[model samples]
Each structure stands twice: as C-alpha cells, then as structure tokens.
Target: MAARPLDVAFKALAHPDRRRLLDLTREETSVGELVNATGLTQPAVSQHLRTLREARLITARSDGTRRLYRVDTELLDEVRRYLDGFWTDRLGRLKAVAETIDDGTTP
Candidate 1:
C-alpha cells in the first residue's frame, strides 16, 4: 500500500534535517548552500531534497551548473489549512466544555 499525500508530506517534515532544509529555502538556495547550512554531505542533502521534492513541498530549478530550490507553498498551505481546521474544531469544543463548566453543568 502507498502512503497518502498528507502522510508523505508529514513524514518528510518529521525529520529535523528536512525541516531545516525547508527553513533555509526562504530564499532560493543551492544544494551546496544547504550542505553548508546543515553540515550534511552533498549527497545527504540531495537525499533529503529528493524526499521533499517527492512530497511536493519543494521545487527545484536548474540555474546554469547549479540547481536552485524553493519551497512550493501551495501544498504547505493545504497542510496548514488542514491543521488549522483540526485545531479550530478542537478548540471550539474545548471552549464549549469550559463554558458548560462555568455554568456549573456537568460535561
């Protein structure tokens, strides 16, 4: 069985190195720059980049001899919206429960 898109994205984000890579891409960046920022080997950074690319979280473009990467925010926005909805719903429920308690009603 294959992992869902959301699952793949979350899995890609689960690694500290991958998260750091994403953070570093706020500006267009190269694998060399990523390696320098992360202290990982070029091949190791490439591996993480491959995972992020597969997850649709980052996009790469060739610039002469170097491949520059940037975060593709659409998928990230989708993930953020999903998480926001989850939290909003849960917090709304919690607020209702608190209001009930304040009213001296059993929850």
Candidate 2:
C-alpha cells in the first residue's frame, strides 16, 4: 500500500540532514545558501531539497538564475496538529495518574 502524505512527511523528517534543510529554508533561501549552511555539496543539497519537495514540506520558485525554497507552513502546521493530539492525550493520562497519586491511590 502507498504511504499517506503525512506518513511520507514523517519519513522525510526522519533524516537529520533533511530536518536541517527544512530549518534553513524557514526563510526563503536558495540551493547555494542551503549548501553553505549545511556544508554539503550542491548536489547533496539538491537531493535533500528534492525529498522535501516530494513530501510537500517545502515549496520552490524560480528567481532568475536561482531557485528559492521555503517551508510550506500550512502543511507543517497540519503535521504539528497531528502530533499535538498524541501529546494532549498522553498528558491528559499523566494528569489523571498524578491526581490518583495525590489522592493516595495506585493507578
């Protein structure tokens, strides 16, 4: 079965290098800038950018001779919201357990 878009995004984010690329692209940046920031070869940076682009985690545009890249914040926000739901549920359970402990009861 094909992976969902969110699954693809999570997979793409699994790499530290790709995460760094996303961080660097928080501000609109070029491939050259990404290479400089990452201390990676131009081709390596391009490959990372392609992965991010495929995940819909970033957007690119032509700027004369350069290609500018930026994070697609909406998609990122969707990912964030999905993750937050899990945190919320876990925290809620923790809170319940804490309350039980405070009341001298085992959870």
Give the winner by TM-score. Answer: 1
In candidate 1 the C-alpha lDDT for residue 84 amounts to: 99
lDDT of 2 by residue, 1-107 (tens): 99898889989999999999999988999998888888999999999899999999999999999899999877779878989999999999999999988889654
Tens-place lDDT per residue, model 1, 1-107, is: 88888888999999999999999998999999899988999999999999999999999999999999999888878878999999999999999999988889654
Candidate 1 backbone overlaps, count:
0
How does each model score on TM-score?
0.74, 0.73
Give stretches of model 2 more than 4 Å off: 80-107
| lDDT of the structure predicted as candidate 2 | 0.91
| Clash pairs, model 2 backbone | none
Q: C-alpha displacement of 71 in model 2, angstroms?
A: 0.8
Angstrom error of the Cα, residue 63, model 2: value is 0.8
